[model samples]
Structure formats: C-alpha cells, structure tokens
Target: MSQYFHSVTLNKEKCKGCTNCIKRCPTEAIRVRNGKAKIIKERCIDCGECIRVCPYHAKKAVTDPFENIYNYKYKVALPAPTLYGQFKNVWDINLILTGLKHIGFDDVFEVARAAEIVTLATKRIINSKKLQKPIISSACPAVVRLITVRFPNLVKNVIPIQSPMEVAARMVKRNISKKMGYKTEDIGVFFITPCAAKVTSSQIPIGLDTSLVDGVISMKEVYLKLVPILDKIDHVENLSCAGMIGISWANSGGESTALENEQNIAVDGIHNVIKVLEELEDEKLSDINFVEALACTGGCVGGPLTVENNFVAKNKITRMAKLISNTAVNDISNTLETVDVSWTNPITYKPILNLDNDMIKAMKKMESLEKIYNDLPGLDCGSCGAPSCRALAEDIVRGFANETDCIFKLREKVRGLAREMMELEGEMPPPFRKNEE
Candidate 1:
C-alpha cells in the first residue's frame, strides 16, 4: 500500500544485521541499521537478492495465500513456465496444467503461451522499427525496475512490451469473462510466481496503472500443494497451450532463442546483468539486436522462491522442450495473433538515485560526495554497515553516517586517543615526589 509495493520484506527479529545482503544487492537498496536490514522504498527493485542471501531466513517474499482464491466467485491459475520445470521427470505439460485444477483452481493458464506471443510481437517490432541497438527485454520486472532506478538513459532501449505473465493474465481474464458471462472483478487471476519481483509487478505494474493479475502465489508454496495431487488426477486435461519454444523461457538464453535473432544475447544473474548493461550503455554492443537480461542465474527457474536447483531445473526444461512437437510453436503463435496482448501503457523514468531536485545543488552534492569518497579508504569492507567505502562516503554526505563510522577510521581514532593518554601519563609528576621535596 506504500508508494511502491514490494514483495520482499525483512523480519527484524531474525536479522543479525549482517552485511551479506547489503553487498549482494544489485541496486544497493539495503542498509543495515539498529541491528536490522532496511529496504529503501524508492531504491528497491524487489529482486529478492536479500532473501536469497539472508542466512537467518529473515528476508521473505509476501505472497497471497492459497485460501485467498476462495474470495472470488471464480479462480484462474496463471503458472509461470518455470513451474513446469520444477517438477522432476514430468515431460507431459498437460499433467502439470491439470494438476493445478485438481489442487483447487477453476481454471489454469500458462504464461508461456503469452511468452510465445511476446516473441512474435518482439520479432515484428525488431524488424519494423529502427529501434535502438541492443533492445533490452522487458520480461524481467526486476531488470526493468533496475533500469528505471539506476540506468534511466537505457529506459528508451527497453522493448515496449508487457511481460508474458501480465499478457497471460490479461488474455485469461478477458477470455474467461467473455466466455462465462462473468464480470472481470468476479474472477480472480493468480500468478504462480517464481520470484518476488513478479509478485511486486503483479501488485504495482511498471508501465501500467493497474495489474491484470489479482494475486500472486510463490512457486515454493504451490509446489508443495500441487505435489500431493500431481499424479493422482484421474483425467489429465489437454490444456497444454504453449509450445516448447514458449516453455523454454524458464531457462537462461531461452527468450533469445525464441526471438530467433542471431545477434541477440541472454545474460542472467543480477550482477552479470549489470555488467552487460554497463557495456551496452557504453555503446560497446551497438551491433547487438537484443539483450535478454534475467535477474536470477538460470532465469525464472533459479528464482529465490523456487524449490528446485536452477541447473537441474534447466536440464528438466530442456528435456521437456525437446520432446514436444516442433509444429506446436506455429500453432501457438497463430493463436496469439487474435489476442490483444500489445503493451499500450508508457514507462516513465524513476530518478530515485538523483542527488537533489535542483540541478545546481545536485552538481554541488556530487562534487562533495567525490571529495569525501577520495578521503576514505577504497576498501569495500562493509564494517561501516554500508556496502562499500564509497557508499559510506555517500551516506556521510547525505547525513546518514560519519567518516568515523568506518572501522579503519575508528581504529585510527582509538590509536590516537591511546597515544595521547600515554603522553599525558609520561608528563605527569611522580607520585608525591614534588610534595615530599
């Protein structure tokens, strides 16, 4: 309900005030203070890196409970493609789709179907418009938010397309409402999410004013619920709508593969994505056609909320993709053309990292920040409760901390005090010597 809706949150009681999260955070949104981790609302992209790194399980993603589905007259389960990869030895996609219905859903929808549509739409956009080189994929909400926060200059390069999850939610809601003669609000569309970023996206959409999805459920929770009913279904419905190409979006390089662009590159892991984005920002990859940047290491399958190991999940997804018929891609692509899946809303830049609202003052602050940074030890040790020495310098300039907060600086101060005490002791008169004389 805050200005920014974040799925990731901290449990203050469980936090040990460790610097693990502060250092790993891609956007540097986390800071440790008062023996707890605090998320900066404006800076947080909800990438779930903190949740992944927290040793005490203090960081958690807020997801809708399974029982929340009963609040609506109808419920639709929108499962991410990564959901299919979570199960072991389950090559039959239909079994997983049917499993959701058995687990208490009125209907099931595959976000992968929408991914296929996005692929087609993206290809058309790439071929039609003289788009900026290395067009960034908008599929990863975390990556999109990262650009909005840190790389405003690269916002224009983001492909103007809704994510597969959003598209699928819209498509499912519209189709179900029309077919069943039910109002949009009467039906609840739940996205079975693999990561916190998708949960945040469902609640506070980036480009749009409102999200089509009604709720989000974590994959880890859904996996637990669905496993008991996975193999018990008497009738496996033929509800597999997405092809292998679409389903392949679960793993790294899958989107680029679907786009079929020779010059496209797919990079995963938030840190690696940052490096690639920096290179792209420098115009080093001007000849590249597209950049598919996923925040997790192995794409959605490697989401912090997932149960399966990312590498194992990727292998499972690859095997399943290969077993499916090749013609299914064309079939799904054709069906997607009939749906209104294009993104109409505009994305605005968020200057969260801006030093000040005033241009002149901001410049002055920047100069002062650099001067402070140069004075501090360049070691990126997080002893100051900041990610790095540079971050500590920035915090000092922003009035959040002082240079003495640095352990090395504090050590020097302590040494100076000790030296002064020693000198004073040496200069002091011998006990009662002057009085006796």
Candidate 2:
C-alpha cells in the first residue's frame, strides 16, 4: 500500500490551476504547481472541501465499484441515514431498505440503529466524569483527523468510541456469520457512504488498526440504481429498527440532542469547526462539556458525494424521522456486551508541522521561515500557489519553493537587474560595446 491513502484526488487534465480549492481547504493541503493543483497527502484530512469547490470538476472521490457486493456469498448493506435524504418524497425509511434488496443486497442493516448504541456509550462516559473536560465527538472522521493534524493538544480531548459505521459493520458480520454457520471471510459488510472522508476512513482507519467494513459504496452511485426500482416494489419490509433519536443523526445537532446535555455545543462546516477548535485551544470553552464538530455543513446530508441539495436533504431527514416516530426504537442497552464500541488504539497527533526531528535544527528553520515571510508581500493572493504568504515562506525553507516564486518578489529582482545592466554599459571595453548609429 502507499504511505498515505486518500480518497479525494486531483484530475490533472481537468484542472485549470485555479486557486479556488487552496483558499477553502481548512488544512492548507493544496498547492498549484506546474499549472495544476496538487494535494499534499500528509496534510489532507479528506474533508471533501476541495471536491466541492473545484469548478472544473477536477477533483473526485474514489469508492468501491457497485459490483463488489456480489463478491461475497451473503451480501449485506449498512445504509447510512444520509442515504434516505438522497431520495424524494420517501416517507418511510423501511421503503428505502427494501429497495436495496431488489438491486443486489441480500440483507440491510440501518446505521442509525448502530448510532443509538454509540449514543448510550457516550452518555455513560459523560456520567463517569473522567478524562479532560469538553470531550470531543469522534463521529466525523474528517474532524478527528483535523484535530490530529492541526490541534495536536486537543487529541486527548477526543472521545475514544468507534463511529457508527464501524459498529454497524461489526454487528452485521457477527450476526450473519454465527447464525448462518458461515466463515467471517465469506460475509462482506459494505457501508453506503455520503462523503470522501468515510471512503478513506474505512480503508485507513482513524483510531482502529483495521476497519471491519469490507467496502464503501458512494450514496450517489447507489441512488442511481434505486431511482427506477423504488416505485416498482410491491411490498416494503419492516427492516428499519431505529428511532427518531437515531435517525436525527443525518443533520447537525442530532448527536448533541441525543446526549440531552445542555452544556454541549454543535458546529458544522469545515471552517466553522476550525474556529471552535481554536477557541478550545485558547481555553475559552472550558465550561462546555462536549463539542460536536462535523466537517460538512448540515452534517452528512451536505456531503459532496450526495445528490440532493443540502437544504432539501435536511428537510427530508427531519420529516422522515417524524413520520416514523410512532414506531418503537430497538433497545440497544444489551449491545455493549455483544460488540466492542470503544477504540482499541488511541488517536495520536500526526506530526506534519515539524521542520526537523532535532529541536535545534527545527528552531533554526523557524527563524529562516520568519525572515523569508517578512520579505514577501503580505497579500495572500495565491499567485505563488501556496495558500498564504507564510505558507510560501515555509515551502522555501523546506526547499520545495524559491523566494522568487512570489510575483512581487520576482518583480523586485527584475528591476534591480535592469538598473545594473544600464550601469555596466558605461564600463564595457571598446570592442565589446555596441557601435553608435
């Protein structure tokens, strides 16, 4: 495997070297070089912001092919609540689950049901009053990665629970294999994802060593297959086993609401999430007990890989939750003993900012970076390809960029060279001088 696995990638042929993506990237992971945008794998969190902002359609996400589900003898689908929002006028979540069986899947497990299990675990942790204050939610893979790369000090503040996707996969694998007398290898659990981050998270896990999910299929890809088959189905199965609290997870503030904690705060959008983390670093939010951050605006419904408009999707999810509120929710109080929801490994800070391993060498490089930054124009015009003037300076100190890459700095050197050329004309030898007209 490669050193770093990223689902969000660049299409060089379609790229126009536009600075649109660099300015919007929360991690400053993109840079235009040789007239095309490039992703710095170490800095990328796979948040899908670049995929949303690129106008030329140059950025795209990598997902498993739809046919991969047939590879297993018994194929199961773990459909995220975000998948329900992609369809129009679907009053029942069970209707959507039945549609999956028509195309290829033999069985369906609602991720929302798994979400309720995670909710119960989180409330238990909050009651214990252990660890640091203001526990961070680990539901969004992009937000967890953002903390590791940018807010290193807040790594400990993150909750150590596995996401609902992982929980759902484990549940499906265990139940199907044991009851059917099939080997674990023969069962394939696939997650229907709505974002690029989930695609990478399933392959290269955040807090776990290996993900139980066998594959990840995009919601957009599945929506295409379900559109024609939905109206044709004769009967809908009673497969959905989640309540309103679990289904609410499709939109922002859903997780916080389930906690029933007044001391918590919820924030969405990648940039807005950064602002909240910065405040937490400054010790401004010590009074708050929990911080719920999601990379995409409007929660999973706003993911770039989804087909519906964000506003419309959010409304659909709200309506669907209410439509099924009368149905009883599955009680997951006994699931903790059956499946492990807590992470086996701790989340660690990814050291991308270090200039060198040696302290003295790193300090010296910091000094050089500051000196170069002071010399350049402070306007972060993106003309030099880096996100900001300081980013260009850091690139120069790292030997990836030259000082003259800045347009203003290059202009200064050109003017100085022109003046010297005129001065040298006066001292040239008679033979070397141009003949007077």
Candidate 3:
C-alpha cells in the first residue's frame, strides 16, 4: 500500500535526468535512475520542493479538475488568504470573493475567516499551557507530514488542531445546510489552494477520519478565470470578513504574529523549518512557547501551485491587511463550540529510517550501510543518482544500487580489474595466454 497519497508527481517524458531534484529534496526521496527521476513515495511529504527545482517541468502537482466542482448540486468556493496577494491592484477581498460566484460558484467562503477563528482557538490553547512547550503549528500539511516521517521524535510537539481549510469547509457545509435546506452531501466545498500539500490534505486528511473539503482547485487556475471577469464586475459582496491577523497568514510569520506571543518563533522554507525542528527536538529552545513553521519560502505565496512571485505576494498581503483596517472581525470562541476544530485522532510517528522490519536484520543492514558510507567519497556530488553519498550507501545496503554506481568507485573497480588481469596473465596456461612473442 502507498504510505501517503501524494499529489506531487513526476513526468518521466520531460525529465532530463538532472540532479536538481535529487540534490534539493530535503528528505532525499528522489533519485535519478535510467535517465528519469523517481520519487520514493513513503519519504515524500508533497512539499513541492521537487516541483520547484525541476527545470524541465517534469515535477507537477496534480489538483482536481476545475470542472470537478460541478459534480454537486451546489458549489461553494473556499478561497485562501494567499489568493488576495495574486491580484496586483485589487485591494478589496470582496471583489475576489464575488468574482468566484460570477464564475459558476453558488457561494464563496473565505478560508481566512476560518483562520481568524483558529487564531482565537490557538491563543486559548497557548494560555492553557496544556501542550508541550514550543508547540508546532499544524497549519502546513507538508510540514506536518515531514515531521511524521523524518522528525518522528517531535510528533508530540505538533498541536492537534484542524486546518483552516477544513474548518472553512465544515462551516460552509453547516451554514448552507441549515439556511438553504440543502443536504450536506449535495453541497460541494472546493478549496482554491495555493499549494500541492493542500490537495493531498483535502483528499486524505492527517488527523481527521475524512476531510470536509469536496475538492481542491489551484489558485493559478482560479486566477486565470478571475482576471477575465474582475474588470467587468460592477457589484461586490460584503463577503470579506476575515481581519488583519487572519489575512496575514499568507506570509511567513503571520500565524506567530497572530498569537501575539513574544516568545514564539516563526520560520518558513522547508529547509529552515527542518533546522528549527532539529533544535526543538534537541530541547535547545526550551524558552519558546510556539513554533510556526511554513514549508514554502514566503509562506503560502511561495507554494508551487501559485502564480505570483513570493516577495511581491507577501508585500500585497501586508498592504491589503492595512487597506481594509479590519480587526479580528468577531470573537470566535462561540464558533469553536459550534464547529469541531480539534483533531479527531492523535498524530503518530511514521518513521522511514529503519532498514528492515526485523530488528537483527535491520541492525546488520545498518552496520553494512555504515561501512559502505565510510568507503564513499563524502562529496555528496549526486552523481550516483542518490542525493548524497550516505543516501547511495543506504541504497546499496537496501539492494537498490551498487558500489560501482558511483563514478569514483567505478574507477577504483576498473583499476583493480586491470591489476587482476595483469597478475592472471603471468600465471595463465600457455595456449590461452596472449604473448608478445
């Protein structure tokens, strides 16, 4: 069985067998083999790092078709706050929300609205001081998956909370069902997402049994459709209710700022997040109260599925927050009562480091792996398809690669064979020997 339902995929036809993806993957999940890059599904967190680095456009994140929204009798669009940063001149979020309705959506629900509600709930959780110190934010599904697979020891450090997308979807379904007499199943809640991770999260949720989100559509697709009709729309709805704090979640430190905690640290970009998690796992940051980690560089704006430049998008988000002059719109403490915002199950560790299922065999494999690693050049040149020498050594121990797969090793083997042949020539039978005479 596939360990994770991955939204990120490889286009073998477009791959150039370059080391770009394999070199950059934080999890070392990618390898160039047979002139094509391969993704180890269990190790891939769908962070879209490979998608970001591929020059040949071989790595792509697969989202639901835009037409998939039409499956239900009623369709509701859940627009992420990052969607606000895509447009250049449009400052009002209401125009963006209304534009979705004009483009066949029955209604629109702002995911940022749910973000505001989650912010309030998070503050309460922090004040309660119930969770482990430096509680990691679970907003980024990619980061959560990375923790589960790579940083398994820090699994308990993640706060158990439903994501804003799920909260928004649940809110939309509940409100529509109650007001319009539409059945929950008849209403389609589609998230206009900024990242590939959200697509996988919507399809197969982390902490919940099933996600309330019916479908996930990319922001780039929605942006193309919105551009044509945005200039024509004469009226805008009063649908932009999410305030400054929630709106700021589009940027790197937005969530940490929302908590209003001076002791908190917010780090973005997958690599940086990994470093921070490493420190946290080592108990170095005992003084900190919260850790807000976003997988994308400039947070959701830097996501592979989004169209805008990350810095430009980040600036627009800050400007938009001030333009609207919106405070936390409403006290969402009561909203938490109406909706289930916490996790349905505990987020458990799913370690991918073990060499085997059997303890003794795994120990032997580790020993062999270490020996192989010691023989490697340690250049991490990625010439052997794997991301690093250690990774190649691991592959060798696992029977996926040969020592001679490495150029240096191959050269050494060639030299050894030449010496052996020279030695054998002196001892060969006279009839089989090649003699200058």
How close to the true structure is residue 117 of candidate 3, measured as C-alpha lDDT?
84
Writing each residue's lDDT as its tens digit, candidate 1 over 1-437 gives 56878999988889999899999998888888887888888899988888898899999999999899999889999999899888876778899999999888999988988888888888888988756767999999999999888887799999888899888988888889989998999999999999999989988887777889999999999999988888788898999877787889999999999888799999999999999999888898888999999999999999998998999999999988888765455665665677765667767788877778898988988899999898888888897889998888778877888889988888999999999999987675667355455
Between prediction 2 and prediction 3, the one with superior TM-score is 2
Off by over 4 Å in 2: 326-330, 430-437
Which residues of candidate 3, in runs, are more than 4 Å off?
1-3, 327-330, 422-428, 431-437
Judged by whole-model lDDT over C-alpha atoms, candidate 2 comes out at 0.91
Q: Superpose all Cα atoms of candidate 2 onto the true structure and report the RMSD in Å to 1 decimal.
A: 2.0
Q: In model 1, where do residues sit more than 4 Å from their true spots? A: 327-338, 421-437
Which has the better TM-score: candidate 1, or candidate 3? Answer: 3
Clashes of 1: 0
Give a tens-digit lDDT track for model 2, residues 1-437: 56589999998999999899998999889999999999999999999999999999999999999999989998999998999988886777888999999989999999998998898899989889886888999999999999998998899999999999999999989999889987888998899999999999998887899999999999999999999999999999989888887888989888988899899999999999999999998899999999889999999999988999988999999888887762242358778778999999998988898887888988999999999999989999999999999999999988999999999999999999999998986777777778745
Clashing pairs in 2: none
Provide the overall lDDT of each model, using Cα atoms, as 2-decimal numbers. 0.88, 0.91, 0.91
Write down the worst ten-residue block by lDDT for model 2.
Answer: 322-331
Return the lDDT, model 1, position 70.
Answer: 92
